[model samples]
Target: MATPLAALAADSAGDVAHLIETALTPVFMLSGVGTLLNLLNTRSARVADQIEKASDLLDTEQDKEAKRKLRHHLRRLTRRIMVLDISIMFGGLAGAMTCGAAFVLFLGSVRDASIALWLVALFGAALLSTVAALAAFLCDCFFSWDNLRKSGPLPKSVKKRSPESSASTTG
Candidate 1:
């Protein structure tokens, strides 16, 4: 009967709407998490630069107490940097999982405007999260490469320092 078929369609639409709602919450959460992680990464990079500068200043100091304080701060900063890196990686993983789940839901048999709207919104959030994750990952890699260059066996410096110079020694 037409009435029974219409009822079944309405039930199916309701189920799809529910699925979209369930998927959307996680998608938005993941997007927010990713953005926060990126912000943390940027802060960590700045802190690392400050730590390096502080280390450089300590090298020129003769005060034992000041040197010790500088070293302590530097160590703390290194630990924080490591923590930030780990957090970013975890956030990226969460974002990827959330997007994947949303994509699965999009493939379901849903026939409703509300369901479509939710699916589109979730997908957009997922895309933004993915972009943030990628940007953070690339920045991390760039910093890693810069670190390697500085610590490499032979840094390609334009001005070669003498073996006894402070520049080469501090480095």
Candidate 2:
């Protein structure tokens, strides 16, 4: 019986080259998933920071309306965090599935056998997971944008006529 190394040696250069090329596709996809996870993590961190800041303010705030607003804002930020967590989880799953597919592909090549079933299952799952992740990310984006638009402070309007004194500035 030939050793695994010998089996590899027996493979034609073209076959090896093709295997590498095939593997590269999923590797590239894995890289994209990594980048997406990084983005999600960063956004989650920002949301956490906002929660911390809001919590701090709520602790010291004496005004009931302001405290209530801060609590509402905290709830929104918490929702954002949950959505991002979903995205990150799905993204990580996709990355793992992609890696599994690549591994199966490589092994199938060395064994010189078709891995159609495993390849399709793994790759398809990876794609589906990626779609789920994208959907979650999109939802998070929409909610966050809407929240910002709703809560955004209005720009100070330029006074067409200035007051005589500091009243204009204060007003």
Candidate 3:
């Protein structure tokens, strides 16, 4: 009886270790999602800033062509912001589900409970949400790049020129 009990204890410890290993993948995924969220948020802030600048220009501009261009820019910026927001939301969801799955995995291991189906469902949801977030991010990037191509290259102020080059141009 003592031998059997000791063997069972060893098996349970091994099972817990396996569960921890399995949970590690989602932990890494959560970190990736966090990084992506930070990137998306930064991009969103940039788009918002562009929108503000365009709005100011639109208000003061008299030329019809210039106003039209500003309007187009504002439209594209608005769409990009929306897409980025959605992506952030989905990424957050993925992170939450991944955390839940990790918790459930540990809980099941400690309790010696069968939770394979629950684990699968949680991971599936997390993966699907992650995919949606990535898709939204891609769409946002496309919108930004397409607008840039339409508008031609960036302005001279955005381009970096060496001191010598600037002095020559001024002369």
* Top candidate, metric lDDT: 2
Judging by lDDT, tell me the better candidate of 1 and 2. Answer: 2
User: How do the residues 26-109 of candidate 2 rate in per-residue lDDT, one tens digit apiece?
Assistant: 999999999999999999998898888888878777677777778788888899899999999999999999999999988886
lDDT of each: 0.61, 0.85, 0.81
Tell me the spans in candidate 3 whose CA falls farther than 4 Å from its real position. Answer: 1-9, 12-16, 153-171
lDDT of 1 by residue, 63-100 (tens): 66666666665665576577557657756665775666
Off by over 4 Å in 2: 1-17, 153-171
TM-score for each candidate, following the candidate numbering:
0.51, 0.81, 0.79
lDDT of 3: 0.81
**Per-model RMSD to reference:** 11.3, 6.4, 5.8
Q: Could you tell me which 10 consecutive residues in candidate 1 have the lowest summed lDDT?
A: 151-160
Error of 2 at 92 (Å): 0.7
